[model samples]
Target chain A: MTTASENFDTVGLKQSIEGTFRFRKWRSIAVPFAILGYLIYVFFAFDVAGLASRARPENAAVLLGDFWSYKTHITRDNRSGDVVASVEGERKGTYPAGEGPEWVAMGETTAISLYGDASVQYLPENTAVINVPDFGEITTQVNARAVVLRLPDGKDIPEWMSVSRNRVSIDQGNWRFSMTPARTEVFRYQAGWELFFFTLDSPFYGKSVGELIALAIWEPRVTAEHSNIVAMIDGFWNNKMWRHGDVFWAMGETVLMAFIGTMGAGMIAFPLAFFAASNFAPAVWLRLTCRRLFDFLRGVDGLIWTVILSRAFGPGPMTGSLAILLTDTGTFGKTFSEALENIDNKQVEGIQSTGANMIQRMRFGVIPQVLPLILSQLLYYFESNTRSATVIGALVGGGIGLLLTQAIITQKDWEEVCYYMILVVLTVMIMDTISGWIRKKFIKG
Target chain B: MTAHTVSGTAEYLALVRRRRLYGAILVALFFVLFASGFTVAEDRNAGGFLDGLHRIFDFPKEIFAEAFTNWQNLPRLFVAAIPSLIETLNIAAIATLFGGLLGMALAFLSTRGLALWPRLTPVFRRIMDTMRAVPEIVIALVLIFLLGVGPVPAMIAIAFHTAGALGKLFSEAAENVDLKPVEGLASVGGNWFQRIWFGVMPQVAPNWSSYALLRFEINIRASAILGFVGAGGLGYDLKTALQWGQGKYDQVVAIFAILFLTIMIVDHLSDRARQRLVKGGALV
Candidate 1:
């Protein structure tokens, strides 16, 4: 007991135990510090400190505001001495002459009823009177050289209102009024996306859900060329502002890109996997070549493939699908070959013993073992590629991604971005569910 | 032959025939769908499939030819792209780090027995699902609108996606963990984080790390893609180079080469690292 043996000794064991504990403790502490240090470095590298200053909280507010609601702009031209109302100030969304929403009366004296008790009136001589909920009436006139603002009771200018020699602006988050030398404008904000289902000119534009249903079921035909129901659908489908038909078509194109890309890759990679698999490869060089080919394809990445393909094919779903096909083919080849290489050899040998040809042996013995794996991978890729297709669509200018980017690029139409985002999320979830279902039903069973 | 044996043989043949018929129908269905999908794609495409097929190599050929003719400039172009490449890698690395931490928390919260508040598991799960469902580009573009243009948005967007994805995997691993260690820790008055860190972490760290590593690989690609959408990285460089047209083909080739090399190297390293981590984890 006193003599310490080489193999077993209390002192040696104690020392080793203490050393391991010290190392473990040191690692536990070092890891967090290392992560923190890296983050600190990344903080500077990403210019995170400047990010706040660079960030536009106002732009974000406008964007978030636009997502749920829209604004109708009523403008009175100073030169013409005339007033007009339009949804979002677009020519296509212009209200017909002397016609507007119930809250608006486009006559010599244009009156606009905003939310709550606030209202606005366009008077003669390009003057505007804004009725505040709490404050008294404020008058603003846009003359040739200056904008005159008359506050209630000679009140000093508030923070909410900005007045200058040529421009006057009053902002109430929901509604705003601005008078310039050239024109006086009022923007009335309302909740919900306006003109989503039907444009201003459509007879079906302002109908309530119940009224629309009644119109479809029993009411007289709104348009002579089409039935009432057909007219409603046509109005919604051909909506100028929202473009529901085009949006749906783009969504479908995105999905189709995924489906065709994944399936096409699978079809190509399946045969290639056999030649690349070590046990089944016809020759060494061929196997290496196939493997290297896969590595090349995968390494090139989809972004490159999309760029290169778009040049030849131009901007379309076809380009996106081909890019995905090219990239996934490499992935499938590598994975499928490895899967093939890992196959149990006894089955193949047993089939061969029955005097079966090589093809027959592969058909009977090899395929069943790997089919489930291959199919599951294909399904998973199919689901993921739906998302990739969206990105690629953005690159290739094809699908819902195109619409989203275009809407974003316009820096207006954030509601469309929100709509497209929702649709993209839903489509991805649906694809996930479908793939999961297939995996469960076919593979697990 | 006996009547009973004859009937049995006939039944067996019928069963085989039915299976064959089903297989044939499935194959035929796939072919039909493939054909129709291709036709639809062709109809909608700017150029016909047949025309585009022959021209697929044209761009690659042009780029490579220009790159080779300017071969002496290739090395310099590659060097110039290194900073952008590093930015891309940093985005991936930082996103993975942050996302992995978030995923650990999400996993712990959503895992049934391991959850601090077991009843809130479904809520956390749905949050993860929603996060997962959003493509990184959506978040990136929105953030770009808010933050102007920078790599930060790309990092955040990728991390968000990585969190949701890694959470799902991490929770799946956590769900299969033995509860004895957790019970042991609780008996000693360890807190929730303590129980997870000391008891469950050792068991699941290897799997979680492996998943995170794979996500890092994916995030690298995502960061590059995000850059193309104005997030500012190598993809941005590549985009500008491509946009410059003929004169900048060498730079385009250089970016592609660097990207290809980085991906290949990282993939190789991670493949090796994952194998080691898993094996070492099992041994311990």
Candidate 2:
């Protein structure tokens, strides 16, 4: 129906349109979808059974702080007729070891205690003979061996609430005691107003059992009245003492590794990049070879590389550093080659016209123009390498991360872990500032 | 006269001699440093490091063959790698979504002559400097303690660090945008946002998208390591296999292949989109 001889002005526009679409049309949609599908397939095919197989690494910091802090015991001494209670390294009021004849102690019948380790301890007594306000107080039968104390409503004490003999001891009271290897027994002891008065001013609140007893023998005033908050603060300070060396060494080692790795990788890749770039290398095979080599290097993650290196080097800083170097070289090489390819060929040609050799052409024609770019690339990679050092340290087992992984799982020492983490963050912040300053000063110039 | 011309040409050639003696000196110094490092490393260690390189070369073929031969044990391998895979994706998603938001916020915040608190340029620069300086891994390691190890902390770490990086690049692109529309908006007394939305954003939007895509590709690689601290991801799978000597090199290779392919495809797409966006503009 159309005239075949008709001149078509749309010819040029049509060819350009078709050409653009040929490369971009189906690709724009299919590529992302294909990637997503591949990711999903990989995800579905992945094995996750080992997610819970390995027991998490223990946090020693948390364990030391939490171990045996919540459970405590109250005991009375039969000979002296004195009674005293200890919870989380702190002792409460003291009474005679046993109940003396014709004496009944009076205080609040109900008492609630908030233990130092963020747990609650309560003693609900049946008799209602003693009463204490705000806190808890109660009185029950005085017996030997182990007797399960009953609540006020005739209910037996909850297992969670049971105070075994191992956790309790009597300072002074009138009572008979039977000794056993396991200290979960109660004794019949009695004490009166004098015992109460003595306990009121005792400094025994925040010392460990051994420390408390030692202090009671040496300095009664200081041992009898310590608080839980102060005890935790003390614990934190003590842990800090042990951590100082590990944290300092780890941070320094990580930073050093990153710096050296970046430098090493940059040096190796600089010359190779010339061959990789099209402008510098006229040989088709050489450019492809260099490009592919660069791809293989950067394609693998540093962590995997670290594992390989560690197995080869036997778990040390050298393996970690090499991992950083190898991984970074691939990345830097790719970028450097790309930059080289983008350089103006005219400059190189100008030098060539002056009968300059290949090396000379590169020195004056290429190096000056790309020097800033190369430095910038190096600086960026250096910043990136600082982070890689941490992961490398964890895998190969050396640095603060060694301590960090152990602390996160074993002890759950969340707070102490917090301290170590703060140090890493601070170190990174400093590195960043320094790198930025250097980049601006040297690279920009 | 002919002799004089030849002598003059020789003098000019010498004057313009391209070899940079200074550059050569610098290169030599670098070589010294490199040599010293290797020497020290070798003395302290042994052939083990070099042997490892040899093993790496031989790993793919040996490992893949073993893995495939015992394909029935694939379930065990899958079980180990699954959680890590989920974690990696989660990190990538979080980083991409939040980083996108942050990039947008920065684009609005930065406009050379129109930014708020012009005096705070150094402050903004310093903050960005700090953020970009701390690598995601470093951030993740620190955060593992604060937030407890899981995927969430790693995601946040990746998002924020990448945001810091992408935001700076976006700001520079925005700064380079055509100022004509801004002038037109200012002439009509339009507010800053109105002017930017109408004038500047259109120009920079495509560049921003391309940059975002590039960052996303990078985030995929970054997220792969989030699991080293028990944050959960593909990195954990790789770490566990390597640690236990599972030798699942085939799986590792497959993953690497996928990741590489993904990045290449994304890059190709971004380039095409950028070219179209820049060229298809309404021309006068």
All candidates: TM-score: 0.95, 0.63
Using TM-score as the measure, which candidate wins?
1
For each candidate, what is chain B's TM-score?
0.94, 0.79
Native contact share for candidate 1: 0.67
Encode model 1's per-residue lDDT on A1-445: one tens digit a residue: 4464754687789999999899889987998899889889989999999999999988989898999999998888889877788999988899987777788887879999988889999999878999998888999887669988888996788899988899999899889999998988988899999999889999988889999999999988878899998888888898998889999999999999998999999999999988899998999999999999999989898999998888788888888899999999999999999999999989999999999998899899999999999989998899889888888888888888788889888989899999998898899888888879989987961
Cα lDDT of model 2 by residue, B1-284, tens digit: 99999999998887656455665788898778766656554444434555666766565556667767877766665565555555576568657767777866664565466566667655676566566655566457655654565666677788888777887888888778778888899999988779877888788777777777677767877777667556677766566655555555656654544445554565556556666766774211
Per-residue C-alpha lDDT of model 1 across residues B115-162, encoded as one tens digit per residue? 999999999998988788788888899899899899999999999999
Per-model CA lDDT versus the true structure: 0.90, 0.60
Poorest stretch of ten by lDDT in candidate 2 chain B: B39-48
* lDDT, residue B157, model 2: 87
DockQ, per model, reads 0.75, 0.17
Indicate the TM-score of model 2: 0.63
Residue-level lDDT tens digits of model 2 in A1-445: 2444343536767888998788677786887798688646544443223323332434333333332222223433333333444322133333333321122232332222222212112222212122223223334333444333334454444333434642322222222122222222232322211221123233332345677555435543432355544543343333322345456667766766776788888888998898898877779899899888877776666756765566557776667778888877888888888888888889889999999997899888988888899887777777666666766676666566666666655543444455566667677777667777988987783
Candidate 2, superposed: residue stretches over 4 Å from native: A1-245, A345-355, B1-48, B67-90, B110-130, B133-153, B177-196, B228-233, B236-253, B267-284
